[model samples]
Target: MGPDDPDRPVKLAHAALHRAGEPLAFGGGVLLAPGTVLTCAHVVNQVLDRPDFAQERPGALDLLAVSFPATGRRRLRAALAAWLPARRADGSPAAEGDVEWSGDLALLRLLDDPGPAALPVGTGPCHAGRPAYAWFGSGAPSSIAAVLVQGVTERWIVLDSTGSAQPVVGGYSGSPLWDRAQRRVVGLVVSRSGLRAFAVPAADLRELFEEAGEAVPGPLGVEDGAHGPMDPVARQLLGPLRSVLTTPEALADLAGRFLAELEAEPEPGPEPATGPGDDRAGVDVGANDARADDAAAIDAGAIDAGADGSGADAGFPASAERLVRLATARPHGAPTLLALLAGAARTQEQQSWIATTALRVCPEQFLTAAEHRELLTLLADGTVPDPRRCAAEALPLGPDLEQAHWPEAVAELERYRPRYGRFPQLLRTVEFAAAAAGPGTARGLGAWSEAVAKRLGLAEILLEHRAQARESAERARERGPQRGAPAPVVQVQLWRATGTEHFSYALHAADARGRPLHRSVRDTPVPRSRLLAELGALLEEVTGQVEPGAVPVVEWFVTGEELDLAVDQWVYRPDELFPGVLGQDFLCVMRSPELRRAAFRPEHRYRWQVLRSGRLALVDRQDPVVQQRGAPVPVCGVALCCPAEEVPRLRAIALAVGVPGVLWLRPADHAIPPDRVRELVHGAAPYQLPRLVYEARLTESPDGLHRNLALVWDSPDGHPETLGLGDPRD
Candidate 1:
């Protein structure tokens, strides 16, 4: 699976469609021979925004930008050399609906050196039971499906999936069908029917392939819901803002103010309230002929997509009209802007138009522009804000929501990106970080939330006081505690990797001594599907149990090779989610019983004692193919990554030496340089590795540092478990 393995030409061969010079992909394609690519013609039409059977072919100058996702982002220009529009056997084009097409093939030839080699060049009948592989076209074949050619037609082949992790969705067209039994590709995957894949046979490819080239694929590198349909609430808030900023000046002012507040140096002092009506409010709402004809006349920095540092200078006038044109013109402008400006405002406006607008709009959450700017800078600059102290700790909450809101906000801000722009949820988190960042950092943010709470009669203001009072009273009541009596509350925990890795887990909703605490379990074995369904259903119950302002932490009890199983990467409630992962919300930790018991050993004792602060050693495995016991002496928790065959033994050696924490990649092929991961982890502590790896996995690239990263984190549970612990049941 390494990049040097010429037999597996994954990266430099698989290609995706993009506008010339852009890195974004529109659809998938594969290299046939040097300089040539084959894909479904519909993908080209889709990218070009043309009708499926548009008779016009691409001109010679109309080259498409292509990139091999598995490989580096080395873009190549490709021209359409051959085209066969979606047509019926009669050679007539298919209808404009979502019907299948038998002849929707296309070939694109690179202008320069095609780096990848041609694929297998033969065509024939396929066996019905033989297993094959296919993938989504946008990126590398990280998640592939095993397909079987169930039925064949003169031009179409019906391929059914045996089983696969990812579904064969809309983006999977034009991928290669690698028939495993024949050890060569038999056809091209042209379309899918639910989980079932429909392919075009190789006979047509040989006749159409001509002399060509190769390439490879990887991640689409697109975030989930990056193209949001806009939530009902978001759209509601957006409506008012759109209506007000009709003229070019108002839009320009808002956009300019947004940019200015984003980079403004905070001034120390109180926020003086301004009047509702300004003398300049009556300034012409209509666009005068004084406006510049060309858009380049405006400051480039204000609208730069790269999030550059340069900015607009003073004397640049504002305009809602010009702003509307820019927003209407650009497709990628997030906030998913839809320009609709209003006519003259007969009645004058409010104190601090931005602040007044923030209060009136976004009734769901009082997220403001100032708060967003402060937070965006913090996230962009990579500052992890800590919970504040004092009354400001109590916004003017540093305004005091760090304790109230920062935790949730900090959680959201992890590995923040500027492209998120002004998402409501994103703003909340940014304000959360600001509140906890100390002093007057979060004054404006706190003021906004409080204003909203007061307006809505919300009791959120007294939440912190109530929690603190409860804690003090409890401590006062239990003055002479000797391991205070446990509450009747249930101790719910989900145990993963206790059995076979995939789709298996053990549940414990009991008290300290393994006695039942939560709801009663169905003692009898019902249907297997029902049992798994119950496990999924219980997630809601577990989520409900979490205290307000607190997160749900899923502690996994795993041991032996089970430690290497990737459980964090699992998708939770995917059907309803915006493609969220289990680890994103849950503070997942793998706790091993073996490591807990090993505390009797001095080396184990030493390891945990020092690793309490998350520090650890990264043990490099010198052995190329075999397991070695050459771990460093007296080290605390350590990373001992090795080849897959050597992993089990290396894990055993660490466990034997009493190491309480460990990390490694599993089923890992060195397609990405193994040594490169060290650079990502250079200054990170052992405790930070899990989050680091989780973020890396989100890249969805085969060449990502998170190649099924697994960890053995047997940290202390903040309670004494060592007093007397032993296995009771077999």
Candidate 2:
């Protein structure tokens, strides 16, 4: 899934069989609906007295339970609701010695919600080469970094383990193999042979649902295309990214043109401006009056002028002809064309077409080093909304050669917002794009296998780093501290008995100084159930020792063989955390005690602060309806209507204060209640943050833009005056 995949929340933790002291993981199940699960029937079948026959009859319900990771490892009882037995075509159950059996799928309904959201039943095809994600229940549930479907039969889809780190082991049976491209669970991994795994195709799953008289829901767009699988050459050249390209031949031709141009001479005239909208006025005004020949020539000029204008004399018609043929044959040259277009589009029209075309494709590889830097630059400075949005979307999904960090990505995105402020479809894409760094970290961790060695030496590295930081701070203090000593900063460390697992907190007495003393250590093992109680105790202990004005700062660290092994360092203010108050407004806004508790964990908070904080707070996301593609999702912007005389104060707040999604709404009347202003400012949805602050200016503004946070005066009529700010027509 590109991002915001609904299926992500519903991956069921596989069922386990508890023996003496060890829990034997036997099968996996996927959440099909609220309180309902889909798995393999054989997984939950109990062997009869003869040992040859396995059935769901008698005491089988008591033996099966479903586990949910989101529910703090809670195991809930489940009962078989439906099943298609593993049997021969003759309808006889498979004999004792018969190993290969068809129709192995089963569905179970949970006694209660297992705390995981349900996964919608998919209607898409399980195609070969599509990216798949399989979570297995071995010891603890672990997700495979990469799983690719190798083949698709009528009833089953075959999975190739070459890309994944873990094989489809025993416990993986009944696990859903999710196709990333289609954004659905296409199959259930039912059996495996060495590195190969097989899953019941989505068609069978849909058929099963239908036979049981259940409607497999929509939002699953189309079933797999009827075209037979692409041959090896096609797979090698374009892979799955070909699905997005509208004119693949054109892309290949573009790439070929680049190659041909490289071999030709450069007739460099005054460099043509190739950025978005550079030719907008020229192209849009009276172009209809121009002959068809002139229009074609202009189109030709777009390609030949060549992004920076150096390749203005290169072959154009021949290149265009070649592009069509190549796209028809195979998108083998897609990557080359993408790389070329990243920097070489010569005209506004060309750039727009390329950008729009790119939005449909999701490349598997990262951008080239030059392309990566250029994309970042475009995001930071590109003016036209479409091209800028394309660059924003491209950055995250594309590879990061520099191993670019999320903070840098976030900053660039923030800069891009105002210039091209409103693309709701792109917002979700950007949110996922920003998170590429975190997954990149996880990918890096997979390659490193010296877990024990790294574990042994990590403490020393951490302490040494901390010591050096303190020394740097002490030196800074001697030179002249930026501010006076901050309120008492206490470092609290939480640990488990393993001497290996631990969590630490550096509670700052004050947040205003933006500094912490980093002295002392305390330890505790935080299971979420008792987390609030423990934090309460820890807070009391630290509060008594710290200065009165000190603001507590806490950070968590998990090491050794923890579930999430990544050494993530995320900080949270004590009051801002769950069961506390960051500010009165925040407390009031996020009022649910249960919601606060669920969201208070280190992993969740770290993810939000690092990955998901665009305009929309995805925290309490409800089930989304079918998203209207390309539509601008609304984000409420603050519209302050005030008397013209008091405009200066409003202007000051708008210009001096920078908050992510806020805009000054200028009403023609320029008059509204003060309380209403506050409500508008705080209550608008995330989408309405002003990209460009517009104001009726007094002095010629500093930045060359006409927009400003204006000081508007009230009309004498005591009616709301109209400003073009909220006008539907820009």
Candidate 3:
């Protein structure tokens, strides 16, 4: 039948049987054929030997009863009829026989009618490739699967049905076989493998009937001009014979009636297979069968009581009543009920009873927005803990919403506030608001901020406010009193003698008495040789031409800590006139002062005194009056030329001892005239040299020309005195 045929049955139409006390069970033509049944020997063998059957009932020795469609009530009836025994020829008890050991097929004769029509049998045309329909029951439904005849034997016909082309579960030992074209019984279902299915041919059944001493029924014949069977006339029949016996309208009407009856009735429970040797002596088979029919009525009453909450349905409780009833009555009711409820909720209408039943039956399937909201509220209020927990776990947010959905989500949160008054919900709301505002705008942020402020208390707020205030103060200014101040200025003075190569610059700072300050060298690349020459000339001019009776002083206001010796030392020249050491007589004055001071000590009775005018006074030893009136004598100026390196120290000492000037004496040829030296020193007057000189003395060469120069100066002097030997060869 087509899937939509209303008269088509959705359940199995055949019954199976086995020896009640043995482990043999066979199914198929037994229900249709009362006295004679066809079955595969393998089915009988399985039940006769199976351990579970033997353990359930011990004594097995006779007839077997069969039930069609093996549902719950049917199985119960079969179980109760297990005591029935098979009868012998004289109506005596018969022993159970194992049939599988015999061959591939078997036949049994019932003692009484099974209340059904005799199974039809047909003679095949023996075509090798004709298609046939096979029916089998797996204790479930009877389904027809296609098979093609591969070969024919005297008793068995082999069919090709394997892999995708395999027949539907034809392994059931007694399943029926029918001709699809004529819709009539053709053969009994039998054995199958990957390559072929084997069936008991109708001719074999005829032979078995003759062997049992029964007359074989003639095949339903066709008219002289017709090509098919005519008995029971294919156009008037239904079921496997409907295509051949019935008209389309009749079939449709019958199918519609069958469907209506099926819908009205509740599903039956499972049934057990019947076997031979069941006790039937005290059993009321008729009354038990009646109860089996009433079982469906009882199931329906249970469903009604559960639905209406009557509390009288003894088989069902409130929590599971609705689901059980719906599942029992309708195969596809669960999803339909839930869908209707969800639909109603979408339209903002009241939820119907069917919808609620669906949700109770299959809550996981009802995942609509309204249902979700309801579930959340229920969860918060603890109304439905189990379902609420399930919804929460399964329906977390996924990647399917738009940005605008967040506002709706917020509204949902507000609506459910009374239900889910937990900290997590509040926190999540605040976090969502902050994120939605994009770190810039304050939109929807007030609630979050207020929540936090309320939660954190005032102390935290005050601490944060103070921290911000301090940060503002720090950023307001770039500098402070302790940083980036100007350096102190130091006053320095320069002096030298006329015609001398020695010159001095003094730093008179109270903090730096002995050391000469150094300054930064300019970035310009003045040649080293030119710099030395200029420095030498400048030294000569400052030291050579100093004025008598006044301290030579050139004041410089220096910033920064140290001075540049190379630049500061070059500030004074030997031949330049200053109010300090001057002329050749200045050196004589410097040398003579030591000798005069030594003689005028208290131990020498103050014999003589040296004066600033280059004059020395002599004292009498015993004449007090003459010693007191000692007159000064003037000495002619004379140059004692030394190496250049000795000039800085000598000039330092001279300036320290208060000498006006001192000349740097050189060999006569090496020295220029005082006036010429003055001009050379003046030419380099702008250059400043270091105030203190560092001297490295050397032994004289064999020719008397000193290879090293020694520098002399006091700690307070402006520059060092350098003295060197003249070239001896000259």
Candidate 4:
């Protein structure tokens, strides 16, 4: 075979030696230096052992012959060569006494030169999954089969052969698997399964050979005809058949037939290459056409090499070596410099550098919309480290773009976003945008809408408000409440009553005569003293009822001495006293003629119950069970009363019912204005009650208790009222 046969296969074999009576043993080797041989330390040891040293048979321990099919049936003796055991890849002895089995390799030095046709050494590393061939055989017509290295091991290799060929049999050892393209021996087929086999990498074998003072041969091309053996059947069929078919007339006929076939085949219509520009002048049309005709079509990919071939394209802004040098510069400015350079261009080099720098600096800048989109495309198409790094670096840049840009960014982010929603930055960015721009602006509202989006997720709140406003305006136009429309008047009845429905008073006011004022009802039960004191103080001011000698007194009912007494107080009617009342006030009076006429029932109990099983019961003071009625009543709602011993339990009950606060009513010495009372009871709750009471406390009084009443109110609104019930002079 010539030195370039397309079908030529390489062989990787092992050499073994059997001591006289001992069983046969073999060690791994490769045909690196052509006719020369390279084997493991154990192989060399077997070759050196003598028959007398280990047993009984004669000639069994004789020097074995090494041969290749290309050299015919001639066998070479092992004794003619030197053997070195402990040598480094540089052909020097390794560190003294460092005969470690991990580097279990040895080299053979042939006494005579093996001439040319030697197997060459390979440089660089091999990538995973690249197709490879292996061989295992000896002499002419030796057993040879094609195999691929499956895995590399510390001592042995795992391999796989296409056909059912045994990787290891008798007499097939220490053969090299030559890489046809590089004309170098890349691996040594050592172990074999029924069809699968493994070869030790040639790079590793070469190091072992060089370490033992042996010269590595130049690569033997595939046409070197160095394959070991073939099946007799295949040989006869292929050999004679091939020779008979090679006649000039036959060749001409075959060529003509092939040409006719090519002509007969349908041709592909030309396709317009869609791109920004036409840069196909330098492209090899023949190669492209061939590729187009092949089963796989040609695809334009990201260009790494420059138009002018200088070196293998680094596909980066700077050479990786240069970048490394810069990264290791004395001033340590490479990261910043690289970042600046990345911003200047959008080349592969710049992208690479930016990605690299981002790993150390701010990754967010490089992971921009354009770069991220581009990187995603590259990654999807199976680009390596660069794509991997691009993806990794893109992670830190939060999804903070506008709503329109979010879909694309999120699509890119989806590749790496955590399944459990742990990406806080992504969530935050989406949320912030939604909150600032409103939910309408936030597109793609889904379960994964950012936390901010969820927070502002009130659907079309503003739109609904606007629609309502429009509807209101339309209604106003249709049914206008004007001055001429029946004077637009309303009559409201205001009522007052003494303790728990003993007597009652009522006044009716019309909008026209009484000047209808807007009102809000807030149910707040206050101490009766508080009401009396407040009303008395107000009467004192409005009526000028100041007396010189008599002690000022303010009663629930102002009659006789109550009118003469100068009680500097203010009184507030129930409706005027509280705002935001959720229920009607329970009123009782004994003196009012209206109450007497109505036959007011003092036995009737009025109370309010909350949804959560809490109750507030009202009882008249004049009733027989006044104290007991006011005792711890199993109430079903929030209660507001003066600050008392029972308040803590009520507060607890209110809290249990989720009523935010309670109003605690207390007796008052002086009247508090209706406005101030409303302010106190409007949203009164327990905790806020003390604060209100403190503010209302008389600061001038050293002994705090004598000042007045301190009312504690607890409600969601937290309003509280306090009135002074002590002697104003003291």
Which candidate number has the best TM-score? Answer: 2
Candidate 1, residue 79: Cα displacement in angstroms equals: 99
- Residue 463 lDDT, candidate 2, scale 0-100: 33
324-415: candidate 2 lDDT, tens digit per residue: 22332322233334445535545453443343333222232122223333334433422212322233233222221221343344334423
Per-residue error for 131 in candidate 1, Å, reads 83
Q: All candidates' lDDT scores?
A: 0.46, 0.38, 0.32, 0.32
Task: Give the alpha carbon lDDT tens digit for every residue of 1-730 in model 3.
Answer: 3555321221233456644543333455433232444454445445455431121232331445454443332321121211212223333333344211112444444454444322323332223455766655443343556777665553466777653244545445567665555434556666556556677654345445455454433332112111122222111111111111123232223323322433445345324223433221111224433223223323333222222334232312221222223323343333432332233232221233222223222322322233333333423332211221121211122111122233344333433321111222322333323332333322234333443333222324433323332332232223332221111122333222224434333332211112233222222334433433543444344434333321222333221111112222232224466422211112111222222122222212111111112221111121222223223322111111334445344333332233222333233325333342232223211101111111101222243222111111111122222211111122
* Of candidates 4 and 2, the better by lDDT: 2
lDDT of 4 at 661: 25
Model 4 segments more than 4 A misplaced = 2-4, 7-31, 34-36, 49-65, 75-101, 116-131, 139-142, 153-157, 179-183, 192-196, 206-730
- TM-score of structure candidate 4: 0.26
Cα displacement (angstroms), candidate 4, residue 653, comes to: 62
Instruction: Select the stronger candidate by lDDT from 1 and 3.
Output: 1
Compared with the true structure, model 1 gives a TM-score of: 0.28
Better of 3 and 4 by TM-score: 4
Q: What tens digits encode model 4's per-residue C-alpha lDDT throughout 74-117? A: 34455434333433333343443332223334444444444344
For model 1, the superposed segments whose C-alpha errors exceed 4 Å read: 1-532, 544-551, 574-580, 595-614, 622-636, 668-673, 704-707, 718-730
Measured with C-alpha atoms, the lDDT of residue 453 in candidate 3 is 31
Model 3 regions more than 4 Å off: 1-13, 18-27, 30-32, 50-63, 70-103, 110-126, 137-139, 142-144, 163-170, 211-730
